[model samples]
Target: MLEEDLLYILALQRVKGIGDINAKKLISHCGSAKNVLKEKRHVLQKINGIGAFTLQHLFDKGNLKEAEIELTYIQKNDIETFYFEDKNYPDKLKHCIDAPILIFKEGNFNLAKQPIISIVGTRKITSYGRDFCEKLISELKPYNPIIVSGFAYGVDICAHKAALKNELQTIAVLAHGFEEMYPKSHKKYVAEINKNGGFITDFWHNDALQRENFLKRNRIVAGISEATIIIESAEKGGSLVTADIANSYSRDVFAVPGRSTDNFSKGCNDLIKRNKAAILTSAKDLVEMLNWDLETKKERAIQKQLFVDLDETEQQVYDFLLKDGKELLDIISLSCKLPVYKTITILFNLEMKGVVKPLPGKMFEAI
Candidate 1:
């Protein structure tokens, strides 16, 4: 159905000013898109805003060769094309007026499932940017939330890297087409990301990454995600634009509080002052604001972490003594590579934790 629907979308997007609203109007007047394509010029003129200027623009792009070229590139790059009507297209982003007629993407990412939090900020970030990124991510990890960011420098890259380092999947909404990488530096990491994450964009291969185009892409990033976080931003920074758009979409917006003296933090402060975003001091606050309960589920996680605190030598000795009980001296000399006296003291702590059983002749076994 997407492929069939794309036939009309590709035709409509090629028009300069004719966007989703106008396209829908035209389709409504003339049945399906397929029918509209075959309809007479006067029928198209009957649609609202389809006067002579709009009609001329429509006819010009309807038969443009660019769509064919874009389709060829889509096949070459293995991009998945999504139409607004398709189930695969994200429901949250569908009602947007500027929602792309077609979205091109790759990888195993599902845009619809999993709650998403979009982290955005300026290219020039601060130490607070890096700190909040790591801290917020660690706190949110238990929820297994999918993180979304623009994949730009500073806060965006920090969020993506932190997610990847934690072995969590993420999504990056790009301002450019899928034909090539925009920043070029991110190319090194994109391949590995494909295994667990993906990049999404509506730009056809022919649609280049232009400065103004980013304004359009910002809405997608804001609309698709459930919430948005601003880490560090100048007063006029682009991250505020994302927050504004998120607010317009009725998505919750959060910002990290920063010192007023810092120039890069001005945007976040301004957002809070304007009531555009709530100030978040910790990721736990974010979790609470979202009404997500991760406290109870993390008890097992804490237990697992505690179990991994044993040193490599202690782990080896513990495993070796598991099957058959062995003397402490033997475990020390053979498994621990430490003095028998030191190993004895270490095993005493394990006893306190009830992780090991002390048997006859100083023998021990995992509990």
Candidate 2:
């Protein structure tokens, strides 16, 4: 994006009543942020959803002054800026309707063609949640997915540390600006994160750290990934809010199940009970569900070898998939006379064997 264009976009972003959704609307109608600001009040007012209050903030001169200062800071620090319309913007996040029109990034990771998953959960993570979160990332290392998290406490930090341990890029989406870190203790990990994955946010360098910023931050965590995984959450928490946002974007959501009495597990269980998220037990479950294992030539060779050694049940499932070409999990269970849960377990084993691949919309096909 041109410096002139970026300047206007920053100014537009500062408009109080105009958010990403409305800013996109104005940009779409006027062709650019500069044009949107240049258009007369009467012209902007005629557009749908452009009402009095929004217009009242659109032409503030202070916004321009602030944008210039922010732009200078950005230039001096060599921070990268991703304009929503830029070709280099995150592919998944770009599709989200409420995604920020501009995002500032401080990382070296490339998001292209890589599977990205956001892991979030309770601030008071239990021992079970910690073990599961760590093991999950360790097992998923072969797929080399970019792990995304809030960089708060508990599950978020666990996921990032696990990713770093596995030598995988992990992104920390911050709630505040670059000028401040939320939990001062986590400042120790910032250099390591930047060395591997990095940080991203829509807020300016000096934007105040506020309660609402977290909710706004959650949207980016949810939108940027193909799936969101909740390791643990209480009955109410920001992770649950992130899951809801992911669902609203029609992305896959997975929740780890816990004992009925575990407080942190309540939110995940509720999501499963309400049919808002699929049950996730192991790394294989997610790998199969997302078809992350079928992407390479070596994996294809493994797929061919899987047909050579099959137990009775594995052979039965493989044969069924071979004949049907592709089928839903429920249909496979019904036709093969296996229970649904049993069928899921069998399919997961089959996926690891590389003879079957899972598809979107809960479908599967034989390799």
lDDT of each: 0.75, 0.89
Candidate 1 per-residue C-alpha lDDT over 134-196 given as tens digits, one digit per residue, 9 for 90 to 100: 888988887787888888888888898888888778888888877667678988878877788
**Highest lDDT against the true fold, candidate:** 2
Q: Candidate 2: lDDT of 59?
A: 90
lDDT of 2 by residue, 1-367 (tens): 7889899999999988899999988998999999999999999888998888888989989999999999999999999999988888987787677899999999788898688999999999989999999999999998999999999999999999999999999999998889988899999999999999999999999987999999999999999998999999999999999999988776789999998898999999999999999999999999887766554644654566554677788778877766434666765785576899988998888888777899887777888
By how many angstroms RMSD does model 1 differ from the true structure?
20.2
Q: Point out where model 2 deviates above 4 Å.
A: 295-367
Q: Number of the top candidate by TM-score?
A: 2
Q: Worst lDDT window (10 residues) for model 1?
A: 322-331
Q: What local lDDT does model 2 show for residue 252?
A: 86
